[model samples]
Target: MLLDALVNTTDAVASTRSRLAKVEALAGLLAQLEPDEIAPAVGFLLGKPRQGRVGVGWRGLSAAMGAPAAESSLTIADLDALLDRLAEASGAGSAGDRSRELGEFTALATEREQDFITRALLGDMRTGALEGVLTDAVARAADRPGDVVRRAAMLSGDLGETARLALTGTAEELDAVGLVVGRPVLPMLAATAASTSAALETTGEASVEYKLDGARIQVHRAGDEIRVFTRSLADITHRVPEVVEVVRNLPVRDVILDGETLSLDEDGAPRPFQETMSRFGADAARETVLHPWFFDILHVDGRDLLDEPLSTRLAELERVAGAHRIPGEVTADPEVAERVSRDAIEAGQEGVVVKAIGSPYAAGRRGSSWIKVKPVHTFDLVVLASEWGYGRRKGWLSNLHLGALDPTGEFGEPGGYVMVGKTFKGLTDELLRWQTEYFPQIEVRSSAGTVWVAPTTVVEIAIDGVQRSSRYPGGIALRFARVKRYRDDKPASEADTIQTLRALLRE
Candidate 1:
């Protein structure tokens, strides 16, 4: 298939607000793709190339641009092959090699294709074609059940692969996709609630476990060999040997555990989130040892517990995790849930996750079955732009332009960020310096005082809640918004949604 075909379909999808129309357009495009082209095409549409961050950035992309080709000739296979080469370019003189290759490739692309390729490479494709919509499109193109494709995608933690399977393989083959002990599945997500009581109301007879201020980890152990993956599914087993050793001593021979890992101070209190992440992202061993606390067990021995109720999974988690299990109690009483929440806060943890006792694990899905209640309103928001500092803080990028995700174009363009508020609060001199140095590297555009970035940075912001406002497109603004920290572990796509903040009006 030609690259123009995919680019035209993306344009159609982005130009419409109707989700059904977008899915139909994408499905039509998917139906025409060859089996081998499906994954790369899906990845490009989602703004994530299958090659994964080919060391290319906005600067690199801009440096390589040239005049466009008049007519379309580039094939999907050609683009994929180019990406493969770019991804492999590394070492002393790799930068020049990539520049040459990118320049050559861009010279053959038309204006629209050039824009699509650049956005796709930078993961800034605000095309309204989110993963869920594309998953539905894949199902439609392949004439497969939506649930089947979704399940396979969630289990495998790779939508591109799932798209290829749904389009090329049989329905039975897709259905046969199951939890493997070694492969990390997408971690289950949680909805937000105002209080423990509210969360319990959504999840009756729940396990109200402590919500830690730590990184999400999925540990897979197979006969003493353990692999640890972050929330994004990047393998970091070597960096966290302590976690590996801890999982290795588990009672079961093979297991898949979902949990959090954080460094603790001498008094055993959880350290600041940045401290934990600094240690977590290190490539070499660090003195700051991280401790793992398992909350749910998905696999034990040969039993798959994902289909089991939370009650069953927690039981298995407790048996296998033993002392490493996270603290919580199963209860239907609101008072008990509230006590757990209070206890978590007093222990310096975030809050409580009230999970339904009878609900099966819904990987990658944020449903009412599991709700998180934090006493303080904190959200993961994207940094849309940064403003130049003035007065005493001169020369630094001081105020942040924050945005909430609008995946369905409820308030604006689909798969776009809706600005909700701005804040220069809670930033230290160190943070300001980092922002000044980093924001320009990802710059998409700039005005007199503001530098618009690619909306790829996720920051944890604490607010006094939200208030209705006409100043922003989301119909709400964050109250007393301040940065808690930058969530380097999270993707901008996972930022809290405008609907989530808008719902605060009722409270």
Candidate 2:
């Protein structure tokens, strides 16, 4: 397919607030696409090339333009390089003008250039928009599982392999076969039950494991090779050589285990999420102190135990893994798991994913399968147009703004659904860079260079809570609303309903 075709799909997806229509249009295109065209086509569909780890916004794109001509995976240094270029490109100096000229450079064809020119400036790579939504649009168009698309894209830095399978057949095909380099589809997540009775009501007969705050990772091994994937399903074997080294120590030749690659301090307790985040990209020296805490086992020696149920996987994982690899399994008792979660939080960990033993792995689905109970904090929201982040945060623009998801003078969209908030926190630097560049394409109106999006991104921010505000559009403000991370796995319809926030206010 022509790059223009994909770019048109992205333009519709990015501009219009109607996510379903965006998805339907893209899906129609995917139905007609060849497998080989999937990666670059989708890249165009997202309106930007996959710069890998250079960071997604202007910062990231700026760096790729100046990067040395070398074949390298995404790295933090790459982002810094991009940031340097972005600063120069946006500046008013002689070198800055040259950088701006570089910003206008394009490998796109003539027709493709016209469409992008009409969309936004500088190749329409403004952030404050959700790549996740665009990701969902692609998944929906291709008729593939959203997470599968995300994981594959994250894993291979290309979706050609999986997209080929999805277009030719079904999600099962992509799930059933692919190069081992790609990451596996992420399992869906469950919400935390506030009360014990609630927890019991939600998870009957299900065992619970400590909710670890450290990085959620999946370790897959085939033959003698090992690969580590983040919850997002991006392969980070090089980034986390330690995890790779640890998996190499596992006895089983072909096995897939789920766990946390916690960034530990000198004492061994889990480090803060920010500290752990500091290790993202590539940093061998800093990574030496990182630790991996094993949790779930999805596949054991090609058993495909995700369908066999969690209990069998756990037991087999323990027996096959022995004590040399994987973390010790804790009890199914909620109290025990809660204690573990508390310990993780107390030790500056993010929160834990309370999992039920014996449940089969539900790739790319979030429900009661595995629940995440983290400390609740509210963020001051600024409404950025609700669009998707990539991967799990595809639809609903779950990576939202915080000025408020509330009403503004009884105007637009029933309540306050305008683009007011923005964040790429909790997301890797690569994700952030993608958004920054993507934002301008869908720019609605607001600040000059900041590119005020349509105010649709309804992000779920983690902060202290509600506070008085006069500076923002919404009357109320988020206390510490920093983008915790993109809630890729959620739908906008399920975003923080007004009623939910009111209830919290009552509390």
Predicted structure with the largest lDDT when compared to the true one: 1
* Residue 460 error, candidate 2, Å: 9.3
CA lDDT of 313 in candidate 1?
89
lDDT by residue (tens digit), candidate 2, 1-507? 444454455555545445466567667777777654555454444333333322223332333243232222322222224334544443346454544544443322243443342232222332212345555656776667787777654434345444555666666666655324334655345554443334544655455555655566778888787878776566777778777777788777787777776676677676655566557555464634567767667666655665676677677766765563333234656576567656656766555555565566665545676665566753323345434556755432334454343322221332234333345456555555556556654454434223446333434467555554454444344555566544432223234534334344444
State the C-alpha lDDT per candidate: 0.92, 0.52
Model 1: residue 382 alpha-carbon error in angstroms: 0.9
Best-matching candidate per TM-score: 1
For candidate 1, the 10 contiguous residues with the lowest summed lDDT are 313-322
